[model samples]
Target: MNNKLSLKNINVKYGESLALKSINLDIYKGEFVVLLGSSGAGKSTLLRTINQLNPLTSGELDFFDLGKIRNKKDLQNLRKKTGMIFQQHQLIERNTVFQNVLTGRLGFHSLLRSILPLPKFDQELALDCIDRVNLLDKALVKVKELSGGQQQRVGIARALAQNPSLILADEPIASLDPKTSHQVLSMLKDICKKDNISALTSLHQVDFAKEYGDRIIGLSHGKIVFNGKSDQLSDEILKNIYSSSTITEETNFTSNEVVMV
Candidate 1:
């Protein structure tokens, strides 16, 4: 349970508004952690900051033994170790599944090497990644031809091809149906366990976070409101994390019942 990533008193701001408060987090290797909160709780912001996609305004952020990566070169190397999966499934619609997965090799290849088609070994690696996601049969199919769930699986394959030590997923299952969401998340959990890689996923659903995460960190108003084992989250903690007005508007619904006179 060695720490793979550590954030100490991290803070982020955009102009006058603060995006993240003094947040401290430690992610151990081979652990599955979930950041849970309503929208705008800084879950996405925190994830981006880990990869240095969003710069920290204050405090220390460290990834493994890479040291403090302040320059572009160091940041680029950090990104190689941290792979990101977005909700949109950010694949090139025109590219074949194999081609999309091959893009993950860019971090390992030279600029000139990546400009051309991937090398034979890289191609085999991409295919292996596809097999890991159970999508080897769709390797030749265009990205646009796949369903939403299939596309997200392809995204996972792409991350696998990167040979990442840590994977960050930003609401990866947000766009899928409930059944598909469960399927994709289950696969993601399996992949993380199988690869022995650490994973941090941001999720809007408390139930999914409880089910899939070994640990859950709840954010509220840009601060870490709760951090503990998934089984430890209480109803009171959930209410506090989701107390915003938006949550009431989005999650409040009741099924209609028929009345016979």
Candidate 2:
């Protein structure tokens, strides 16, 4: 895998409080990397900094064409190539599923065209994205009418419609039931692999990270505690990562799932 995104000594802060501390990492093309940690561990903060959603207080964040984007235009272009998925589906509840998916093309469409109405090609692309997520039947449905899982699928399709080279998913399955979570994660993994796109997903479920990620990174208190292959993640390392005293076998979420050999 070739390096597609790089961050060096990256630090993020909200006013006086620091969110990430001296972060350094490289994300390669077509790699499914997961950020794992408990709440307030800064996993989401680190992921957001990649797409410049949270400005770095210090250090370098470099993308493919924009390099180190400090200007608005450069940041806009950088965002166009990077897709983002949030915990909440973030869909327009009043809009049709097709219209919500078409929002992804706003980056590519001119302001006038997007504001007026989606063009014919844009409509086709939106439909194609909806079909890719297996939601072709829901295209005409209102976003408010869908289940949490279905709405998230819409979110994924929206991101896919952007044709991004890199995807940043912040707790994509955090809101779903166990079965729904499994389905969504499986879909995300399949999409990334099939499309040959890179993804960085922040997950609260350690077992889910182990099962779905090509590489696993564990963070605690804004610092990386573990960075290695998923198979190398022993209980000892996981304890250190979570800083927990009680580590239970029953807590293992991926033990019954298929492990990627």
Q: Among these predicted structures, which one has the highest lDDT?
A: 1
Candidate 1: C-alpha RMSD after superposition? 4.4
Identify the runs in model 1 with alpha carbons over 4 angstroms from their true place: 246-261
lDDT of 1 by residue, 1-261 (tens): 335788889999989889999999898888999998777889999999998888889988777767666788878888988888999999999999999999998988889978998889889999999998999999999999999999999999999898888999999998998899999999999989998889999987777888889999989889999999977887667767765533442342221111111
Q: Which residue pairs overlap in candidate 1's backbone? A: none
Flag regions of model 2 displaced more than 4 Å: 1-3, 244-261
Model 2 per-residue lDDT at 125: 88
For this target, which candidate reaches the highest TM-score against the unseen true structure? Answer: 1
Provide the overall lDDT of each model, using Cα atoms, as 2-decimal numbers: 0.86, 0.85
List, residue by residue over 145-222, the lDDT tens digit for candidate 2: 999999999999999988888889998987888899999999988998999888999987777887898999989788
User: Relative to the unseen true structure, what is the C-alpha lDDT of residue 100 in candidate 1, on a scale of 0 to 100?
Assistant: 95
